[model samples]
Target: MSDAVAAPVLTIDGPSGSGKGTISRAVAAHLGWHYLDSGALYRAVGVAAGWNDIDLADPAALVRCTFDTRVGFRDAPGGEPRVLINDVDATDELRTETAGAAASAIAAIPEVRAALKERQRAFRQAPGLVADGRDMGTVIFPDARWKVFLTASAEERAERRYKQLMDKGVSVTLAGLLREILARDARDANRPVAPLRPAEDAVRIDTTGMGIDDVVARVLALIDG
Candidate 1:
């Protein structure tokens, strides 16, 4: 492989609403590197499966959908990246709680992870890659030069998510979001395959009260040091 193909990666792993997505994108843009939102990939797969009526309970069907799914991403500066599923813009749908639940369910299947592993790695190229997801540092890019794990209180994360949804005009209660965040945290941390956890060498950032720019600066500092 050429040097560009083997470009360094900065993996930012964290639970939902901990700001990894925002931070990673900022850092990547600052460094002029590519960005990978692995969670979006899973969401895309889940969304596609639903469209095809493939039962999430059926590991076989989910794996097939993963293989057949043609996921795409479009950069939308200053906003969330647009996600396309099989040539259709499913960006809005992919961000819904329903899609998140489905993604979580299918992500636990070893077969689904295996199928998406290479697809995730393919984003590494050119200047570098900044990957954001639960296992970006642990499973997908263990050799990443810069690995950071972000975290926040479950309640805080839920509140952040609640406000985001409300801003988007989605009707949701903070209590329900809190419950879902807690449940997903437990499920992700306990899943049998590639469970969610920080790599031993990863720098842990408690972003409970930190601003997005501050967090991005801290991540960039890692490269400077």
Candidate 2:
């Protein structure tokens, strides 16, 4: 059989509310590449676990949930992609602080991360892929042709998340969101498996005051450069 070159991958990794999702989606659309929201997978698993009343502390149950959860995404041309869990539209729930917390909890479990690793890698397909998550560069796609780690100060990220939730009419306190983001950051950074960090050679962007279009252009410039 003739050898075929593998499709390229661009990874955008960062802590919660770091603009990874926004920038990754924009870049992917510009390049006409497939997109993978790895965080959504974990959130789906967490949501699935809760539906089955499976305890997050139970690693075994979480693994089963990972395998059993059927996660699908439907493109929403001008808005956030719809996340379906078990074919049910759970996009709203998935965007909740509760779901984010659940995802972080399950993500810290080594078993769950291991279970989801292959699933994340499989998103890399023909044309290319823009994979976004906490460990997209470090663990899921270490050899990705382009890798970017976007970060903003804790306060800034919290502010961004607050505004996002407010826009959706989800009541939330800025102080509470800040606390949650700090806690999740600690957990993700100290997690045993695939801790969140920039890959050694990955470009780092502190998008503390940058606009979405500016950030998107910078990332695209990398691949085009």
Candidate 3:
């Protein structure tokens, strides 16, 4: 097993719609480093179990399914991340509200997190790794060279989510989206395994009013410095 000290990692962690995903991807692209969307891994597990009719509450069953399953990410031309589960293109399937909620639930389980820990860490390679997820900084990549916690107001996040879904042709009301976002945030922050929080040394960026380019530029400066 490789020690955290052996490789450099940049972790960007925060709640949904805080632009962590987009920022992390851009950072990885700018730095020519690898990227890991850790949340997608849990979502893939939830999706696989759902397809097989396995009960998510069953820890033993989830552990078996988590290990037996294989998940991978592929960049699409212009869209959200594509998730491939067990060789099948489940890009669209894994993005639904159901999958996201299921992922949050499963991620709370100790055994499930234990199963995916090494897989997430293995993304650290020669150049570096930019990891994005709720716990990337708090847990998975605690020793990261640079850790950032990107966040925005709940209302702002909901609006962002609403626009994203609408742009993707998914019909969703703003109020409904707001409620869901709040609920998920509460759950994620209260989970026992790796509750969402900024690492002690993490730089917190409130992207509520910042432009993407500005945020990227600021993050780049931090990385360079």
Candidate 2 residues 132-208, lDDT tens each? 99888888888888999999999999999999999999999999999999999999999888999999989999999
TM-score of predicted structure 2: 0.97
lDDT of 2 at 34: 93
Candidate 2 stretches greater than 4 Å from native: 1-5
Model 3 residue 203 CA deviation (Å) reads 0.3
lDDT of each: 0.93, 0.92, 0.88
What residue pairs clash in candidate 1, if any at all? Answer: none
How high is the lDDT of residue 146 in model 1? 89
Candidate with the greatest TM-score versus the true structure: 1
- What is the per-residue lDDT of model 1 for residues 1-225, given as tens digits with 9 covering 90 to 100? 886468999999999889998898899989999999999999999999999999999999999999999999887777878999999999999999999999999989999999999999989897899999999989999999989999999989999999999999999999999999999999999999999999999999999988988998999999988
Q: C-alpha displacement of 32 in model 1, angstroms?
A: 0.5
Lowest summed lDDT over 10 consecutive residues: which window, candidate 1?
1-10
TM-score of each: 0.98, 0.97, 0.95
Candidate 2 lDDT score relative to the true structure: 0.92
Task: State the TM-score for model 3.
Answer: 0.95
Can you tell me which runs of candidate 1 are displaced by over 4 Å? none
Q: Candidate 3, residues 47-149: lDDT per residue as tens digits? A: 9999999998899999999999999877786655678899999978777888988999999999999999999988888678889999988888777889989
